[model samples]
Target: MNLENKYYINNSDLKITLEELKDKGIIYIENIQRGFSKYPNLIIEGSEEYVNNAVKQLVAANGIENSYADFYYGRLDEDEKNKVKEALNEREIVIVESLQLSKDDIFVHLNDELLEILLKLTSKEVLFSTFYFTKYPTLVWGNYGRRYPVFFKDEFVMETVKEQIWV
Candidate 1:
């Protein structure tokens, strides 16, 4: 999808987010758009080697089985994909999203360090498919009776009251 003119995030905000993520043991590099387009997509790039190292570090930190990294490149060839898959197979937990990558798409394991880092960067908790709702939700479910008005009318108070009343 063309991300032009879309409000994915501001540069400063993204920097802050990345800083926080790094503090939580995640590393990322910013890929600024070089062309003339006014609205450019901010791409987060990292090498497979770097990601592997991060996964190992995370496994050690969390004291749990290795997990997978949440991010992936949408345009990787077969050789690159296999290399990534091999690395992921050696881990314990895998976090991946279905994207058009190569002929054979494989899953990888991830550790808590990477997961926590991703959560911080995205400002949202993430989890496996089994815990999808608890991790992310497209819609919120709630119970409301007729006594609780779904549609209501309220009076608008535009004037500011300066007097302070003591009870």
Candidate 2:
């Protein structure tokens, strides 16, 4: 892992739908054809160690950092997939239309096809997963999700999500 890369933890309430549900089922896209890129940042040596220590300090503060965060999907059996699927279907959209997209904005397309992609995320080191559907605020998931943001539909799966962070 590149320690120099920035890491953050969010503690604010999110109002967006799933695609980030602080926003909804999102693809975090840009105009790929235009070669839009992420903002450059200072990469100090040994930053990961520093960030880890800082993260530890943050965790020491109650309700500041959610050290124990997990999604509600684990609670549902077959219904888990269905819940996500239903959210996608209801938030159905295609970006082909004449939607004016900002250069810095992430372009997300929600639909039934997203169900399969959402289930394939398994990397423990993943920056973001479908866990955004859980009860915690969007900031909790963005702790790592910001690096590689993924979103799902809004409201469609709020019933299965917890609004607070765990532990």
Candidate 3:
């Protein structure tokens, strides 16, 4: 989804939402996507050592220095994939630089493992497997119900692939 095209309703209170996500095992560096991308993907912030290791592995895989400094969904070679997988096995954290987020700009994808916890902030009456923040600033489930799909504009799902940076 083009975040620029769709209307975004900033949430009145994001503190509660941030706290809730913390309770769900989602680690993020708020307001850390401004220079990289318009949408903020859930980035992993870690210590210098870990971030450096992650960068080295990513550069080896993509053959692009500093590419791991931002959020991207690019094809990785098998060797590169293995290296990233190995790093994740150690449970390292990664982050993006110059990305900043306010509570109002935050949104989570429905498929996120932490979605169940996020839904607690929304209505109990609406049973939505898929979710997104709408113009109302209320959590809405279902893609057809909103202008953009959940995690459409600002989203990143870092599975086993660990692209990271120092905070």
Candidate 4:
């Protein structure tokens, strides 16, 4: 049985009750961050029977808007590349880390972390972007006018930055 159940929460103010759902047998949980708090979407994928039961329990406790019928399933495939060659080709290493105003301190910490990662990840000298979101300390990827922000969510750290890096 394909287990892909989609659900939406209208008022995202209520903290997500992950433990309760996990106890009911949730195999995986993916948060769809649309850069908006009002229409937050979460994908809970697992056994069809178990996910449905878990959703019922979640709705009972949180009263979150449930759209169980509309679920999206995605597969992630990693692209293997030679980092040294990419660097030799003058591809500016784009290190992105998602950030929030409340956790600006976290930004400072992760920025330092990204710098360390870049130092190890690339052979070329690292340069910081001064134009976009200077406070976050962006890195230029390729050449002139190709400056990439270190705290972006699109290219490199899309998966790790949201929950792991910054927080």
TM-scores for all predictions: 0.21, 0.20, 0.21, 0.17
- Is candidate 1 or 2 superior in lDDT? 2
lDDT of 3: 0.28
Q: Write the per-residue lDDT of candidate 1 for residues 86-148, one digit (tens) a residue.
A: 544222123222233233222223334344433332222122111011011111111121011
Question: Relative to the unseen true structure, what is the C-alpha lDDT of residue 58 in candidate 3, on a scale of 0 to 100?
Answer: 32
Best lDDT among the predictions, by candidate number: 3
Q: Residue 43: error of model 2 in Å?
A: 14
What are the root-mean-square deviations of the candidates from the true structure over C-alphas?
A: 21.3, 18.1, 20.7, 21.4
Q: Which regions of candidate 3 are displaced past 4 Å?
A: 1-37, 65-160, 163-167
- lDDT (CA) for every model shown? 0.26, 0.27, 0.28, 0.25
Instruction: Tell me the spans in candidate 1 whose CA falls farther than 4 Å from its real position.
Output: 1-70, 90-94, 97-167
Estimate, for each residue in 108-145, the C-alpha lDDT of model 2 and write its tens digit: 22222222223222222222233222222221222332
Collision count of model 3: 10
lDDT of 4 by residue, 1-167 (tens): 21111222121121223353334332222322222232222233344343334323332332222211110001111232242324422222222212111211211222332333333332122322111111111222211232221223233333333344333
Consecutive 10-residue window with the lowest summed lDDT within model 3: 89-98
lDDT of 4: 0.25
